[model samples]
Target: MRRREGENREATNLNVNSLETLVTHIQVLSGNIADLTYLSNVLKQSGDWLQSEQTRLAPLLGELNPSMHSLGYLYILEAHISAPISKEQANELLLSVARFINACTAEQIHLAPEKFISVCRRFKDQVLLLDEPLRGVAPMLTALRKLQTSCEQLTALHPEFLLLCLLSKSYKTGLSILEDDIFDFDQPHDLFLYCYYGGMICIGHKRFRKALELLHNVVTAPRLIINIAAEAYKKYILVSLIHLGQFSTSFPPYTSGAARKYLKNFSQPYLALVESYDTGKISELETCVQTNKDKFESDKNLGLVKQVVSSMYKRNIQRLTRTYLTLSLQDIANRAKLNTAKEAEMHVLQMIQEGQIYATINQKDGMVRFLEDPEQYKTSEMINCIDSSIQRMMMLSKKLTTMDEMMSYDPSYIREAEKARSIFDFDDVDSLPLKPDIDAHLKDVSSSYDIDD
Candidate 1:
């Protein structure tokens, strides 16, 4: 019994020594950045020590020295970012860092804006590189907000903070930053990251056009990174189907041949599904998606692909509107490949509300009456087109007039025109055949010909 008690005392002493060593390292790192290599090593040691000692120290450490714990976490983050850590190690380090950041008071975070920003930026980079969602993103965003409140000027220094905002589902904050043009990406990867996250945010807000535009930027970047481009293409295709009912004709023209080919090869399942959708082969589309279900899930795109499938029935139903003056819900179910009449009715109601199809439903007979009068609709559309054309032409005229004013004031342009006129004059002089006699001879010939006539 005495020996066991002695062992417990020894373990307690070891824990105390470990805690003291970690505190010392954290203090040294906080005071200096001259030896980042040594600091990195010490911080890593501190992290390992903290992990082993966490259960025993959790209750007392918060009250005894919270600032020390926070600084120690900052050191661990700095070290993790500087060193080459595995994905698992990075994740674990980030989890600890996040917890520490969250535990700190807003005032504590505000007081250390630089350190907070440093940690947030590094954490954002890791999250982006791993291409996985982090659980602790909310705390990171909260800490960033506090840092921003403390030093608004420093916000611009870390544009990747917007990424953390988005990841934390802080869409309003991210959108504000995006609108303000505060994000400045210096690297190709960073640009892709911004577009990818921005597109997702747009998707969440149901801004499909803006989402497509952002994803298009990612897929069509000059230095195309395959994984990001592939993911962007998947989202682009899904969003395109949702927004335009088909891929826009203008989309392919912007993409390079290599990108197109790569997309075809890498995204064959999606391409097949799109073709089946366009051709109105509902069964084929369903089968293709089902067969590639694992692939879709692995790519994290199963939900989007399923959405495409849901939309296929709508497209088919819309096609029926063109051919039939009226379709009963049963007829729509049969023609649109829907499972039941109720499903067809729901789709038709939604389409009517969205202005995709003009129709009124009869609740009694379950009949759908098409309200579209082709001739009147055509005439109104034609008038709208004419009005739009006139507006565009007026804008074009203004633009041309402004351009002419600028050209008129350009000395180089005026000098070039004078030079061109002189050249033409010299050519005419050279072509005069060195004789007025040539002109007189031609006149005499013309007069003789007139007399002969």
Candidate 2:
């Protein structure tokens, strides 16, 4: 009996020791997988090797123990390859892999919720590559709910995540979540999320100015929970400018930051205006300008916005122009009426300074208006040239003809000419007439400097 009991105790100790050994091996594997992540980071450095290694590891992930996190680590490493993995294949593998992680996470929750959280977070990191299925927004709403629950359970402080959830919810509903008064703005972290979410919601609702203000606050927030917040802020500002109907400015919608990756895609909607406005192509401008006119007519400050749009486009608005005002500055000011003469003047001056408008100051009235017409200006110059040339022609004809007549009949002039002819060789032939080469000498002298051809 004693020997049997001792053997049983020894066997239990042996199993625990073996489990420790397994954990150690899993940790080493995790380190190796981390090195693989660096390869993914330097994609251009070892792309071929990384791809082959990724392919080799895909099948091995299924056999790893979830508690060890080897499987989760491998899945994430594969996800970072930057090449398109088959979505269907990724979906199948990730769903099963995520489920395994979830089960292991649930088991570990009581023992250490932080570990479970870490495991669950890895699924999110990898699965972001998956395209969200197009549905009636139910899946996104549900996902937001799940994320909220997870955030609560895991004690995560990711402001951008929370903001995205609120934004997705608001976009899906077409209504403000803040209207229900569920938001707690006193909490800095929650406030950060609320502002970002509210801003995005405003964008969807086409309240671009409001959205800009909200995004600005979130952008300057001291504790940014995500690296992309600054970029998101810039995009929001640009989009707001577009929403406000400013399209002539050179400020594009997406430039640097997180938007740099998606700029190519985000740029498509504004391409027509970009080409038209940038190249000064009148036909394209007409089409795009018309589109913006129609869009802003539905806005609350339609009258004021319409005038500004017309002035910039030199006709009625048609399509929305992503001009700088609409895309960058207008959103910050909301859709407030820029109707006052003073305000309009300031706006026009700003446009002029931006080289979008050309204006001249009327010193008499202290007013600025569009620069003078080119054709009309040329005509005025031509009129002045013709007037000056007519006066000069009259003076030249009177002086030269009067001088010629005087010399033709002068007795002293005839006697001197006769004497010179006698000395030159016989008073033969009439004294050579002194006719001036007038036309040739006067060819370049003009009485008028007119622009008319």
Candidate 3:
């Protein structure tokens, strides 16, 4: 009886998995056929039939067990709704999908290729074979393989990579089915992959028009795999379009507030700075941000802007670090005394601009100095003091290490080691220097301090 129960459980699990797979495959197939209808005159008659397939699959999905994978599947369906879907709804769907995938992983559920293919074949029987999927068989298989590979490990926090791959295939496949040869209908999914890959490749080749055509179809995918893909691809497409000087056409989808602001981040600063005189582009950037005011004001959008700013700041710091690493310790120490190396360097720059500090490079000695300010001199002095302290600490650590080795090997040396270890002095030459006004940048450096109870 127990053995029979185990077999029954396995069968039930398989049934659920098969159902989910079929529903997803049918959904994609229907989406492809609908897309092909718009592309060519021949497939126009199959438009209603494609919609019916989606309607049919939706119910089948509804019948599946309410597990995380099922929920994730439903979220994908939600993402397929008609144009002008609300961001809140779209985001909710994405989040749900993410959570569901995570839950499935947590439950130790794993999906494999064989199971997926079996489900795909079943779906093809009812959906594709019934009315001839616009994209032919080979293209569809290739596209599904790409999608399956890309969609692996869906539990990852950023599923956008997988989503992009899937949607790209969907878009490409649909376009292929619209091709002249009816029997040559490239599998909608594989065609989608070709378009996506081709677009990116075209961009690299500087074929802006070809890239735009491929990407535009992706943007217009009715059964969009993920809202994030639309927003992401749209930005790239607009960038390419703008590069080609198709400004009006390259603008943006006016409805999706998030995508608009994101695109602006790329073009806005340049528009504001270099094109300051170009009132039209400036107006365009301003209009986009203002139109999305509510989205801009929302915490989510604010967080995104904050992330961009943070990334830029970190990049600047890295650039400075690389620059500083090349300067000699003496140069660093000299710079540090004035205002800490970073500030002193900036101050020197300011003085040069103000004509207060001029470079005095002696040709005979090959020595350089600045006609420095008193404040600059103090900053440089402090920097040197800090550098000396650091050197002293390094020397002390080396001596300590030597002393430790001696004590570890010699009994008599233990006493000296104990004494050395017991000697605690705030004025120890090796002590890290405390800035007079370190409180000003307390938040920046305080975390580096090690405190022991």
Cα lDDT tens digits for candidate 2, 1-453: 978955753453344323233233344433454432432233223334435555455444445565555333433344443345565655664565445544342222223333333434443433443633122133323323333433222123233233333323434453334333232232565565556656655655556666776676655554444433533443443454455444432323432233333333434434444455444344565576477654333222233333333443432111222332222223212222334445444565555575554565454565544553244435777989888889977976886788789988999979977986788532122111121221221111111100110
TM-score ranking of the models: 1, 2, 3
On lDDT, who's better, 1 or 2?
1
Q: Total clashing residue pairs per candidate? A: 0, 24, 19
What Cα-based lDDT does every candidate model obtain? 0.61, 0.42, 0.36
Clashes of 3: 19
Runs off by more than 4 Å, candidate 3: 1-186, 189-213, 219-237, 250-284, 290-453
Give the top-scoring candidate (TM-score): 1
In model 1, the Cα lDDT at residue 90 comes to 72
Alpha carbon lDDT of residue 248, candidate 2? 36
**Per-residue alpha-carbon lDDT of candidate 3 for residues 345-434, written as tens digits (9 for 90 to 100):** 454454356444454434354333534244653577799998988997797688678867765999766776577568831111211112
- Candidate 1 lDDT: 0.61
What's the TM-score of each model vs. the native? 0.52, 0.30, 0.21
Query: Could you tell me how far off, in angstroms, the CA of residue 293 lies in candidate 2 after the best superposition?
Result: 15
Top-scoring candidate (lDDT) = 1
lDDT of candidate 3 vs native? 0.36
